[model samples]
Target: MAGTRVPTLQPSFDELSEPLRETTFVVVDLETTGGSARTERITEIGAVKVRGGQVLGEFATLVDPGRSIPPNITILTGITNAMVVGAPRIDSVLPSFLEFSRNCVLVAHNAGFDMGFLRAACQRLGLPWPAPRVIDTVRLARSALSKDEAPSVRLGALAPLLGATVRPDHRALTDARATVDVLHALFERLGAVGVQSMDELVHAQRRVSTAQRRKRHLAQGLPAAPGVYLFRGAKDEVLYVGTSKNLRQRVRSYFGRSEQRRRIRHMVTLAERVDHVVCAHSLEAQVREQRLIAAHQPRYNRRSKQPHRGWWVVLTSEAFPRLSVVPAQSPQLGRTANPLGPFWSRAAALEAVDALHSAVRIRRCTQRIRRHDPDGTACALAELGKCGAPCAGLESVTDYAAHVMQVTGMVAGSNDDVLTGLHQRVVQLGSAGRFDDAATARDRLAALASVLHRGQRLAALCGIAELVAARPDGSGGWEFSVIRHGRLAGAGVARRGVAPMPIVHLLQASAETVRPAAGPLPAASAEETSTILAWLDQPGTRLVSSTQPWSLPARAAGRWQPFVDAAAVARGSLSGADLRRHAVTG
Candidate 1:
């Protein structure tokens, strides 16, 4: 089997038809005159055809590179100009090599480099160069061997580490045999490491190389320093938006894993380009990410704003600001007294108003009833004091209109002034010795304090958290959380057609509670707390607070505030001082 030329085993097609009993690989090595693709030539080619991971045959030949061999390369590979003066060139030998590589995964050390050279050579020779996939043993070895076992990943270093006996030869066929032996050793190691498929093996190599490169890059500089990283698909669509304290490091993680690299490879193959924006602060990067996510709606972003639905309407023309539900129609301002909806549906609007009526006194019947039926008593709700006595025709429409105004003002959340006025009334009651009414006012203040206290939770998390209350259909409510930096923060959805006041307070509470820990924030140079606060102050940004709870429609009450401070408490970062500062006492 050694020098006497073990006859090349060429099994008949029928014998080869049985399912392979072992894994099969084709081991190959090329000896070239130089490294440059333009000037180099394959002076010697060697391959061992394997079946079921067993070497079946070996092919070896010397090729006339057509150009004179470099003196240094001749010294290195021991294939001199005289040696291949009359040998068949690559054009003549490529046909047999392709046939040998047929139906098998090609194996080599640094396989891509070798394949690149082979493809270039084949292209030059006008050969078809079959697009056969290949396996790289160098990559396999990186994951297989302990760092201390081999000084380098070179073929010479691997031969001894594998302990596969081979002649001390660098000639084409000898080197090919050694590589095949080394490859089998690597396959054994890979099997031990749970690698099973050709694709898995190749993918493992890609991950190893990528991870190594990433680690190297990180070591060269601070990874979490600050910046924006962009991921783009082959078609140049943004795939993901991320900001990091260390842009270099975070970007590398996406490319370092086999699964992630596979996705990136898919993207890169389709990608026409790449772009990135470096920022002075991570908050700025976050703002940009949100803006982009809203703008482009990239597929990878977690928080996508869907169109809002559900609305509440009140007719101003009616004396009591007749509350009603409206279906989602084209966007238009409410008719004078009739505020069109924020209701998800007419039914939801009815349910909401009913629930609010129970929580806070609001009349629901129309005045037109008692006007026409002056003799009959008012509707049942009117009898129950749930509706003004307009139905009984006892109360004038003008007087009925005052109660309706109260209902609308209470529901809109814009009546903070009213709440303050109510607080003043509580003081007045306390002075007048109206203990019960004073106690009720005190309770309301406590509720407001509870609402404001919720904002204390934001300090423990690592990122910016935002809560958005949206009606998916302009009627019903949906809640969302926007986590930026490294914290969890979210706000509850506001009921449709409610004044944006509660929503605004809710956002404020979310920000206060879920803000990242007061450590060095990511990309702090680009954005500050003031910047984020200013952005929050923008029009249409919603908030929530408990100050006007009873006045709020029931639909808006279900949305819960995200408590980020709980995490901070668990972490010991929310010290007594922090908690005291955040806690509100009535």
Candidate 2:
């Protein structure tokens, strides 16, 4: 026993401080009758289990494949039918090999080929296969050695380059032993890149950019919970804002294999720190993310930024009402006027305005006029009877005021007379063979219907000062949210066994009220209102309570019924180009 050292037992992979040195690895190689696992049979199986550079055990066997080995396979692996005639079948030999490689991570040059054969054998024999953690030396070598360092990553080339104790001779045992050496060589290379644990080694195989690797520290300390994360630059300015159900995994992914986008790669390089705001649930996280992106206008975010720039459809408060598209921050209007939309674009709002104008003879002139201003002149549209010519004082103020009332009633979703008039006009145009004009009218009707539907929905939500909603959280609990004036005010979780009344009350009491808008519209932007609507629409969500009343019409008040029928008729007769032109105009 003098001067002789005994091999020490390695620690379990989970408990090991240095898993690369302490975990057991079973390097495997197989010789088969052919390449396909489903069609071919294994002729030989070779595997060597090692830990801390010491051999724990070795498994090798000649398997009787019950079929003829191809000439080419015999020449390559030197495994012939005669040599395996008296050998044990795979079912007899597989149990011993499995025992030898138990509690070890399987390693192979091209693991799919070897593992596929073993799994097939297990399936054919009705044996339970222990699905071990696998590591492919091919992927490891590709990650460890660059193209210049090794022109070819093939096992035969890598075996000699890695200084293997025994060169691969196409035999299973020799190839398996060679692979073990290559695996060790890759571990050594991986250590230089700060990969020590088995998990780190596996993750290192992904091709990550140098900048992303350098910023890995920014992801540290991110909690594994639902939250919104902000990637801040060197000056602490937010570069990106995102939400995730699992903050730690999501943020860490930016430095790991999943981050392949070039823009995100560049963002990672600029990000100096990642800050997060934890949320009780994913819905809350999403709301917070949208709010943060809208507030900070992070450089990397493309959508939902500049919500204040949205457009609205408003009826001017003149003696003769005219619909117009105005910015969200438009100047104060007359007391008689009513605003309907926070539409995504001015063009979209204009489509709705044109729909109403075509049906009613409200003045289309843009100039502001006093009741009896004599200098006002009638535009050509007035001469053609398209307008009542209130500018030229051709129509009485009483008649114009009546038209204005009808327009206001339509916007308020209380009447559909204007829509009915537009539908009649569309039918007349189509019967007269003016298909293009008919198509235009149909498009305007659709635009108006869409805007009115959205406006009614948003107004109903905004009219509520306080509302509570809850839905199943998939964890034997309920997720609750509180809204104040169409904005998310608070959110929380309630367990299954406990009464949710207290939690609901707590959320309701904590909910913050948004400041009322000076105009008729809600202060919340379209994006904010949409976010709240989406949460409310989730399956199983129910209104627990509300302080203010809410009611949406069972159907829109506009001549929507006639418009629908007219659209159906127009669609059947109009050319595809005409229909598309109308759609694109909206």
Candidate 3:
């Protein structure tokens, strides 16, 4: 007797005990009109509510699917049209079913099929889904039973193996009742493996890999707030970066069943630690995520922005200025010349420059011509009546100064000259019935406007040394942003009943000092500045303080359109119709 071995059912100190006895489960089954939840409708609903091995209640209903049941479905379910003639529609019966299973974990043989129909019904009726926790006995049986123990985890095959009293016959209540027995038997087998806690029982569904289950402890210290998180490898290099409104929950889910991406699963396997930065708001979290991805260039983060790689349309400071596309860091830009863009591509910058040439003549030639002393040969544009031919001495230096002033004004935040010049060409082409040519000119107008619009806005923000803006956070709190030279230098929140000005001053003092770089986009990447633009553009945002005037130009392109006749009359630029043809210059 001293040498004999005895197995005890009770757990020792470290093992969690008696989780099934404390939890409630609502086993559910549905017979629908067809296989697809989107096109089909539910014909019957059956649910058995239980807790601690006792039957708490039973919910059974005949749902009128609002359509005739298909012959195949009726034959399978044995619920004919005449049988459900007096049944209540799903809209009328859903409220009672929802109340019956409120707060209980849903159990089913194949839960996706059952849950999809229920979710579709809720969406159709404009009802909010409680989105309760679910357990599938099929997954549980596969995890708990060997192939020899149960040949199949289907309800009919599992009923006899698990000693279920009810025989499943494709009917709702019978299948749900059989699933209840299958669920409990699987739980008993899991108990032998020391999985007794509610969390462990949910984990035994086997959708979660064992490697991921072991790594859950890494998420324990993360805060439940809006933030950016970085997953670091064993060597302390960031492997992946992400942002979430609830940092703890989002990170913890990587170790749970729903996260099944092969790449993310591998990321979890290699992940040794998680680091987080809590943010004042969702926008701040998003901005920080972009900055982090830009900084680390983590292998798993897609399309990370490489700062200072953007192209710009620059005007040269030579004897004869010409439009050229160059990168933001190019030294071709001079102190007297302001660049037109930080365009995404050289081709895009060239297109915008072509549109500018079509509007006002910035000579297309690369040759440097001195005033009143050059070869009088004309280029192609000069022959096409497009250029003033300053290189050939046909146009004087005094005459070229007018075009220079127009371009300088346009570069200094006005689009009237370009808009007017492009408009006359578009109208003449259209009046000549050359619609395709007009369309091409109009497209040029759009491209120029798109790039210059963003360029102006970003330049205005970059010109500012410091700016503070606040917006309501929808919870009696104020979300504040401190920007320096177009970068999100600092962000914070002043909760209810607190004065925001002091916080604004504090954030301003502690914010990052961003120096204006040589190029047009002085600080921050285009993506980062664009993110800040989106936040400041949101409704209810109010400017708290600023060092420079944060404004667009009076003749900025947004309010102007290329309607020569209508605009000339409305703006009174032309004195009379007699001079309308000569009023706007090419």
Candidate 4:
């Protein structure tokens, strides 16, 4: 399709700014046989070369996927075997594509997915993937769109909602054109936030990457318990708020050793310190997390806490007016007489209500009597016995109130009686020949069970806590701990007075790896940083005491010497945030 009759109505590249139009952006899209990276293959590739804000040329070709396209995928992308027949394989076309993209940035709607696919294809071809930088219009839209705009963030949702007036053909070129329009509109809108060059965009993306990395790392050591965690940066300012169970465990996960550990390592390098609060239960933790995340507006967490913009579960006043989830910012929240969730998403709210109905058999439909006044009949749910048909006047107000009480009970994580009844129903279904019904009942029972099982469990060894410290001896030797509850947890199997402490200390010290900070902290002085590194490079030392874990005494100078020396000699490289701030200032 490169040289065919191009659409005349398409906007010319000259309409864009000199820099943007001359950027040689490869406006690209890929048609995959399925969604999964592990299981799917790309069937078509499409790109249009834009320069001087005009489409200089176009490129598109189907590929023999070497496997049957799933029927659903065929329907979605309209690409079939016949379309790709005799078409060049990815290997035949990728080389030329790479050459074309050389020195030019890539552009895509969901660029991550596309880049992943491209990387996979390159790997299959036994070629080193040149990961040229990419610009994602999807990211741009989220950053650029105002809060008052429609509650749509998807590509198809964006065009009409953004007032772009572009055709929604789902073809590659058309999609690319629409994206260009969106980018143009955003640039026009991004007055102060406008990026002057491609490098600036790259810098912004790195910040995002760093934030995501930190979140994932902190999540690593999270225990199954409920608690709250904080994300702090330089000057001890909290950058984000989160709640989790098992504080140490959750914080540890953020620093998990993996290729994707960008945020964890970056943040750790930048962080001056950390703080946390343990919660008694998961709900308490969640509520606290939400409040804090909303209050702090952390850089890393998803922007879910806009004022009056969260989601809500609305119970309508009319007969059979079904419970539905809509934005809290919407007028729908005000109209509903009864509602359950101001949940983060409509899906989350619906899931909550569904669990309530499944557990307590609460009628989600509105009152039958009220429906008649509104000139509507019972909904399908009420007619099908899924609802109690309050709209039909079959259930009294007292009865309806009882159902509402049951739902409230479910949401509050209380009402063991209702949960017991639900469990009994599941047991009965399983004992009978209704296996399918039993399975569904069992799932619902599990959901309800989790809500009730939110509180903390006392550790059996809670009576005693131990602190252990380790320091490198200038040679290959290390010294370590055996402290317990502000004292030694126990005496070790050491010969004579030494006790068997060294071995235990080493094991404990190795288990507790420090996580990197998420943002920049003031850089350690050259001497201090070097000393720290030197200490780290030396043989491990263990600190042991017979006291509570938190009561372990700080290590003395002799023990700290190795680290001190390392810090003195080690380089004090600029942290991720430091670099960004510096670049901006410069």
Candidate 5:
């Protein structure tokens, strides 16, 4: 028994672990009459089918393009019109070639040229194009071999380096056979990157910088869990901040074979180190990423960097209050008119203030006035009854204070009396044929309404001192987060059958102790407020606890349709008239 030889079972190439070894590749080449597929036609076609380095079949045909072959093309390809006089036309030969290459991955050197001619032929005949997965051997060879090793990627230049059995001579069949050999050689080189599947091979053809390849080690230690990653440069400054459900995969993708944005590739090359902070779930990772980006203002991050640059609408504190658009840097404080803001821009904030003035009898003058100063003169706004005229004592302090209270109530989302008065004025102006005045009043009302709605939403979010909410984590479990006065404080996870008390307690202990800002409004940054609002609005998020009362009105004050419609029409007509005038002058 010891001397007896057992049958040695050898593994077949088809049974190898690599998917490319089992894939059928059809290498195609075409001799065309001109450079562009739109104006040219294929004079000849050739294809070679192979698998596991073995040729399965070969196909070659001369196609009559129904046109004279150019002298330049005949000289370059050594194919003459006399050679294809009796040949079958491309329409007759296309069906057979497509049938021969069916269910196979197509391969061509500079694939766009060959594939374009083939597709153009199909389009001309109104035939359904056989959409096959394609690979460009030129790109693959470029990624696999250095320029020093192969100075040119052309089929003629690469054939010798790849040990092609047949040298390309501009004939279609010879070039196709040489391409098959080059493809196999490139496949052998792709093994260095562990490209075992067809999909990976396709992705591996992208040109990857040597620096990017070397820094792939930075991603080796990352955990495959939800977290935020920071890419740091040589000076230890954060270059980019990103969050992902699978940290390792996302980090590794930066070094993968697919081509990335030029800016991202530049950043990756500059990155010296990668650090990460683990989170309980994806939601926490997203919130943390936004916060970090806002805090660091990283060069590679484009969003959430300048939340403080937004504008705010404030009613300046005075004997007679007047709305003003102020920068977010100088927010209104306690007992000094209420602040409603984080408007996208100063223009929007000014529009809101203008709208408010059109609705209420607030002074618009920038001059500081002492109450009941006899020397102070009333402005034209007062003469027009747009202001209470406290500068000239035309309106009593009690009456002016009442009007200020009305404006404050509207900002607080509690009263719509001013809105009602504006609506009546618009109706009266329209009845008297004063359409311009009516449209102006309507514009003001709309602007006021937009700011009121924005303020109400932000205030409601800030009103809650401590909020606990839960949502499905999409893994048969629950994700919980704690928000403290519009800032994400802590987060945790609870499994399906386990008691959530421990997780809840742990989150509360780790939660940041953020003292609520003094005032009826929240003092958090615009980015923070928006993040919390978006999380709370997600479907299936349950509010477990809260300390302050919060609710939005069922209907907003800006719902008046008549004024809104008239304003829209007036603006459109004005714009149309301007366009016509410009046209005539030009």
Candidate 6:
């Protein structure tokens, strides 16, 4: 036993892979009435079944597309409308094709087109799509054959070179037969390059990098739990961070050919170790991932670079209050009466502020205003009668105080002056045939209403010191969350036989102590709090207990539904040209 090393048992992902020689390939081809999967219908289905180079059987059928074939498509595919007069419809034929291709890997030239039609048919017929393994001959040919050997990967071009007996002429059966020959030719080429398993054949179209293939060693013993995962480089720098419902399967996928992202592949290559944090629930995993991203700020993670860039509308505390849009965060939330939002855009926050301006003529300028105006002069807005002219002392402090009270009530989720004013203005504009002005007013209403709704909901939850919520975890157990100040303070699962209240108390005891932040998101980041709110809103969640009253806001955004829906519809209806115009103008 001297100078001997005992080997540690490391699980290999490839242990589950079956050999290619035993694998069945259903080389398929489809003739369609048109190119679009949504609009067009399948005209013909042809599949040749093969195992280890021996032909087992074939399934070929003409489908009644249920519509007239376009002349161009008919001319191209040679499948005339008259030819499919008595043919079975796709619904009638799908069951038989499903039976034939069962447990077989699908091979096709430009697989997306054929698979799109097939999957769409499954969806339209209210049948589940058996998500089968797919291999595209086009990609395979590109990988195996050089441009000098074959100028094009088209079936017509390669059928002769690959020694295919059947020539492709756009007919489904002929093309399907030709595809089988192409598949075998590519398989033989792949064999020389050491590809010999079902997994390898499926992935041979695009080879996974050597670094990716070798890095499976780093994925050993990853737990099958909801968690955050980190890929750390040799220098102990965190290269990337991500979360998954099944950490083991998700991390293993990174070392496989399915991971096609250039950045991810490079990250895997540079990765020296895989680190993970297992969480009791998805909410915890998500929050942890976000926190880790903020702490480490890994170069590969693109989303959370500027985590607190979301905009919030705040009211300045001064002689004459003005609406101030600040980035929603602790540091940015200075001297405001309950900041309004994480509005996603500065222009949208400004729009909401302007909506309030329309209702109460607050000063819309950044210039400092004194109670006693020394200049006694007005700006352009005041001259045009748009502003109350606080700088010019045209509006008294008492008058402005009343307007500021309405603004504060709105901010505290108690007033709807902005909503009422904007909605009525939209109605007035519509009646007067000022359609464009009405639409503008409607957009402002929607923006402000949405922000108010979210702010109110968040504030109600954040106001609570401790709240317990429970939902069935779908497997005879209760999933519980202890929320303190809008953030997920604690989360755990209680089995069926256990006393749930005892577990609830334990969760409360172990929960993170959240300090109230100055802004709407009191305990955690907006992203984390929003995710928790969504979890609690799921249909079956029950409020187990609460320390404080969690009541809804006084003025709900529900009354402004008409303008909100119209705004949504208008946004959805905007053409690409209109979108481009808006983007440029905004």
Choose the strongest candidate by TM-score: 5
Question: Per-candidate TM vs. native?
Answer: 0.38, 0.74, 0.74, 0.34, 0.76, 0.70
Q: What is the C-alpha lDDT of each candidate?
A: 0.52, 0.78, 0.78, 0.52, 0.77, 0.80
Give lDDT tens digits, candidate 1, residues 241-280: 6677555444444433354545444443343333455543
Q: Write the per-residue lDDT of candidate 4 for residues 162-233, one digit (tens) a residue.
A: 666565465666776777666666656432343334543443333233333344434433344446787788
Model 6 TM-score (2 dp): 0.70
lDDT agreement of model 5 with the native: 0.77
Q: Which stretches of candidate 6 lie over 4 Å from their true place?
A: 1-205, 329-332, 372-375, 495-499, 574-586
Worst 10 residues of 2 by lDDT: 1-10
Error of 3 at 382 (Å): 0.3
Sorted on lDDT, highest at the top, how do the candidates line up? Answer: 6, 3, 2, 5, 1, 4
lDDT of 2 by residue, 1-586 (tens): 0011112233332333347778899999999999998999999988999998889888888999999999999999888889999999887899888888888899999999999999998899898889998889898888778789899999999988988778998899989999988888888877765566776667776788777877877766777667899999999999999999878667767876567788988999999999998787877888788889989999988887886677776777665567777788777522324576767888887777777777778777788767775457888888788898877778877878888777777767777678778767777777777767877787777667767766777778878887888888786778888877787778887866767888787776666656766554455666777788888877888888888667865445433645555566656665676664443221
Q: By the lDDT metric, which is better: model 2 or model 4?
A: 2
- Candidate 3 residues lying further than 4 Å off, grouped into runs, are 1-26, 30-45, 50-56, 61-107, 111-151, 157-174, 181-214, 255-266, 334-336, 560-586
Runs off by more than 4 Å, candidate 2: 1-75, 79-137, 144-151, 158-206, 333-337, 373-378, 420-443, 520-523, 554-586
Between prediction 3 and prediction 4, which has the larger TM-score? 3
Worst 10 residues of 5 by lDDT: 1-10
Error of 3 at 93 (Å): 7.8
Which portions of model 1 show Cα errors greater than 4 Å? 1-23, 208-257, 261-586
TM value for model 5: 0.76
